[model samples]
Target: MNVAADPAPAARPLDISTFREGGSLNARLRQMHEGLLERVPAVDRIACALYDAGEDLLKTFIDSTRTGHSLEGHEFRLSQSRSLSRLATSGDVRILDDIPALVQHGEVHSDWLLEQGYQSSMTVPLFDNGALLGMTFFDARASHAFPPVAQRDLLLYANLINMSISSELAALRTVVASAQMAREFAHLRDFETGAHLERMARYARAIARAIAPRHALGDEFIEHVFLFAPLHDVGKIGIPDRILLKAGRLEPDERQVMQTHVELGLEIVERIIGDFGLRHLPDSSVLRNIVGGHHEKMNGTGYPKGLAGAAIPLEARIVSTADIFDALTTRRPYKQAWTTAEAVAEMRRMAVAGELDPECVEAVAAFAPRIEEIRARYPDED
Candidate 1:
């Protein structure tokens, strides 16, 4: 084995400027992928596989070389792939100089390389504090392309990629914390309990995960719903205390006034976007969907915009079930807490009656024990 050489001056210096400004991990990775191709013409393909440690699987998440290649959803068991498992444990960059030699030797790694039509390749493991996070692959069609010098430079790039992931995660936590503060502000004036918010968010995530396969939802979408669900009732902060805190059931006029909370929520989100100057960001459609359409019903009788089934955003639909289920199970000023069986039964009835999304309701029901655990964990203060 040839000793790996140091990074050459010709190799593009790993850029950390974007990391300082808190750029997204996915965006930075894409730039690195493109940069690798531009910096080394020998690189015919570049891909990233994120490790799902909890599931002991690897997912091909990002690929610049194979656009629309159906590799987005591909997953592999780490236990089954000896070469990949070795790479994970060793944390060393594997430089395959001759693909045909490995193939002739009946190697599994060669089988995979030959499938992708590559003659030479380099696999660099991405690690953070000794734990394997993922790996980046650089493939070429020409032999002896991934020399020792190339491996060294790619190793530097992989380290930068790991740092980028950490930065992105820190940024995401900041965003989530700020959003949670907004929810807490609303909770001060509304009937929402912290436990309610916690349980509802979990339920929303469960529903999203269950429907991900059928609706083509990804892990990112599921995470967004989980993070944004707590803000579904954020607009209630704008409602008048007399109406929001009424002891009895709301009157006709009071109900109409209460319904404006949805609109108020949208306005609040817009003003927040403006205040923070985040308007130019990839946009606030996710927040708007949860705030604006969470109350919309399937039969078009729901308010604010009266969006019917399919017209309502799926994110909102998922939250709707979560919010309603929590509301029914938790005691409020005007109503006592219903039993688990009672709440689930009523939600099931609403699903059958076309009032709630049946699929979402089913998903929530399927995770009943998890929901109960959340409720127990975050019980209301005495």
Candidate 2:
């Protein structure tokens, strides 16, 4: 394989910062494709396809030039095209200067390409740690469009494309893994109902949105708070059932044991981070903070670290408000659920007493109307 560095005059170095990490994967992929097309004037179309390892098929991910019949969501077996398969396996860039040769040889998928007026094409393999992830196809109307000069630039562009895709893939895997962990932890507790989790997390998001400006929080941060909020009490699984499932108020020692759930939740999530090799992800800290610090108060009165006021993680503050709101409004074995008015009045009292973040409490108070909708949507079985 020819891996010559591009010696041509730099065509305004690729500004990868333009590809927003917070955007959807498809949007980022399209942005990269458009950037590549703007730089490489000879290429007419760029299509990125992902290899579905389970099915042994390459499915279309996104297409830059959807001219002749959209191949979006189209799939083809990897074994059907020998050249492409070779490129996929060998991690080589296949520059087909002639398309008719493959057509005359009855190569799979070639006839379709020819019918679409693509005379020549190039396939750049995308790999992550030696595993073939997929391929990006650059098609042109002219033959021999990808000569040595073009190949150098193409290879450079391919590297950029690989990084963009791989990062998004990693992000996707992290999201799935985090959700799976939350679900598994919730399952460990018989009392951890899904409806409660859903309601509380949304409440967290709402509070985050309200205080976002003051705290300089972005949409991504708010999203992480919502995603990780449900795991706030995940550590309860570690407490003995005698304490965790006790129907009545506990003794001081038993209450202390229950409070240890905060530390236990942090440890559980820390283990998950290590086990999944996601310790490098900054977003993972959101989970840890919520699990460990939600109990912390604004006046240095809460448990665990006794973090007070701004010392508490912003995410934990938001989850703290949401969790309290849900707990106050939802019926438990020990107490009857408070009415909306009663819950709001009591929350205001807590905020005044400095047990809760006043700003977060205000935010939740402002979003009070949505709470009923969420509650109705995820009502208890009774």
Candidate 3:
């Protein structure tokens, strides 16, 4: 097949630095598409579809030239388009020389493209480590514009793009896995026996969602808070084994040492970010406030930090209620789990005595039934 020559200057060597770790995936994909378009001339339109392996379909993730365009948000079933579908399913690059022939043969979805002024096009399937990841389509208004040389270059660029995406996915997976391991280690320490890190994370998320409306907490913040909640007790890692594993109540000195866990947790997170060189680092102050100040009394008697009232971060406040509520309702070696009614009464008392944030306590009270449902949904980890 004679694909159109790359009208732009020779493509630059792929730079790994162009692909950054620890950023929003959607933003990264959009940036990658724009970068590709700039390097590949004769490409007036670019549409990127990310394959959903579970769904067995290509969902358009980025469409750069979508205004008055027919290809925007187009869903192409793997069973419908013989050429492009086969390319995606088999992880092959398909260069079409005769667009009209393919359309007539039922291999191309051209009705919409024809209306949008797209003529000849090249479809390059993106794959990483033997798995199909997605496909990129470049189209122009002129028919039979792409040649074999251009097709080869496009395929090479597509492979480069796939490599970049694969690296990003690997980095994200590492972050998630590290977070999980940290949570498991923490669960072995204390807070709630039989209740694992996953349950606490979910509870924190539920509470955040419940309070989001009143506090104007954005969805992204709520999501981050949920994931970060598991790390609230990570500072316990720094506490001496005796204090951390102690089976009985602690003396004032021991209690002070134990309270240092808050600072320890913040330091641990800071170290993790530093080790990974993740930029922006999610404002450790908020997380530190939550991890350290969650135990603080509303009256300024809390340990590690005497932050009181509105001085505490809202995410920390939400997590404080969730963590305490979960602790109260779950059995532990030091104490038997209180009945739901008893737990509610204690929370109410705390609220009245100004030991806890009134609004947070009220939010937990309203979420009581939903909290029970969450507990039921995720039984204590065995």
Candidate 4:
């Protein structure tokens, strides 16, 4: 009787949270895709294209495509397509059962779908609260594959995916906005510094994209760097007003105190992360690395930590180059703005001297035209 009673086996619990994880949005979306396939096998791709209202741009952000042909690094203005603008504005959900029929619309997206062999597509606008975020797309290889039943599942998955993207982005916006507010409250936000932060964000993004191929960096990493670049100097708020706002050169001892901002910045970031309950926010480490390691020289001659070369996080290396490039090209209280040529030459010299990452310096140099354009767009205090 005892032996017979020992024969019972436990049933494994049913699992459902497939996309819940602390990782890149792309990875989470792929996880969701895998889970969706279990119920709706016809769904071939799940993708999100994000909107940037500043430039009226909708750009490919992440995707999980079984076909392996994804539309990355592609962007178009939201106003360029009447159908898309209408959908985004009116919150209309689009179900194109015959994608080829859409070719007559002359939309680049329609043309791309045809070229990619996507036969059926469902598109819907994603929103955070009342504001439009972007669009979520469900594509299938077979026409009319998204039947009413499949449409119900796709809509549910779209909301799940949007919750993840919108929540993560909202967390990031909180961190950035809170830090900027602190700077503003402390009287540390000025026209020059504000403009510098704006330009640094773009410059960091340019360098990240330029070197992405060699580094295997994805769009997620690029976006985080762009968002966090400006916060690199946010810790200067901790230093004494005498030192931070000094009109003249810092003395050796004062310079030592000024250099403490790196650690100070890291502390500020950590405190913000903890206070906001964002300990698990994906890529939070990117912000920490930018604040902590941006000052460490490649030759081990730089600040708080003696991290050198590849020991420095790649994001930090990228931001350091961007920060230095902006500093060199921006007119400072103590120095005049250097020409773009002069800044690149100096960065090249610094790279050779092991003061900066060579690849990053080269990235900045390679992105000079864009750098000039950014400068023209967000020029230092006129």
For all predictions, the C-alpha RMSD in Å is 8.3, 12.2, 9.6, 4.4
Q: What's the TM for model 3?
A: 0.57
Error of 1 at 339 (Å): 4.8
Q: Name the lDDT of candidate 4.
A: 0.85
Cα lDDT tens digits for candidate 2, 217-288: 654466567667887887877788788777787999999999998888777787777877766565677778
Q: Rate the local accuracy (lDDT) of all candidates.
A: 0.73, 0.76, 0.65, 0.85
The TM-score, computed over Cα atoms with residue i paired to residue i, of candidate 2 is: 0.59
Model 3 per-residue lDDT tens digits across residues 1-382: 9999867556655433443544444445446556655555566666666665533556555545633453433345566666666776676666655565556534345666666666677888877677777777777766776777667666665665667656654543455456456656756435434344556666676677667667766444555665567666777767777887787889899998988888777777666666666534444455566676777777787766787888877777777777877878887766887877788789889878877777777767776776665677666654
Per-residue lDDT tens digits for candidate 4, residues 95-203, read: 9998887555567888888988998999989998878899999998899989988888788888888888898898998999999998888789753378888888888
lDDT of 1 at 314: 92
Q: In model 4, state the lDDT of residue 147.
A: 90
Measured with C-alpha atoms, the lDDT of residue 79 in candidate 3 is 60
- How do all models score by TM-score? 0.65, 0.59, 0.57, 0.88
Q: Give the least accurate 10-residue stretch of model 2, judged by summed lDDT.
A: 66-75
The list of candidate 4 runs beyond 4 A from truth reads: 1-16, 104-108
**Model 1, which residues run further than 4 Å from truth?**
1-31, 37-190, 333-341
Q: Of the pair 1 and 4, which is ahead by TM-score?
A: 4
Query: In candidate 4, what residue range of length 10 has the lowest lDDT sum?
Result: 7-16
Better of 2 and 4 by TM-score: 4
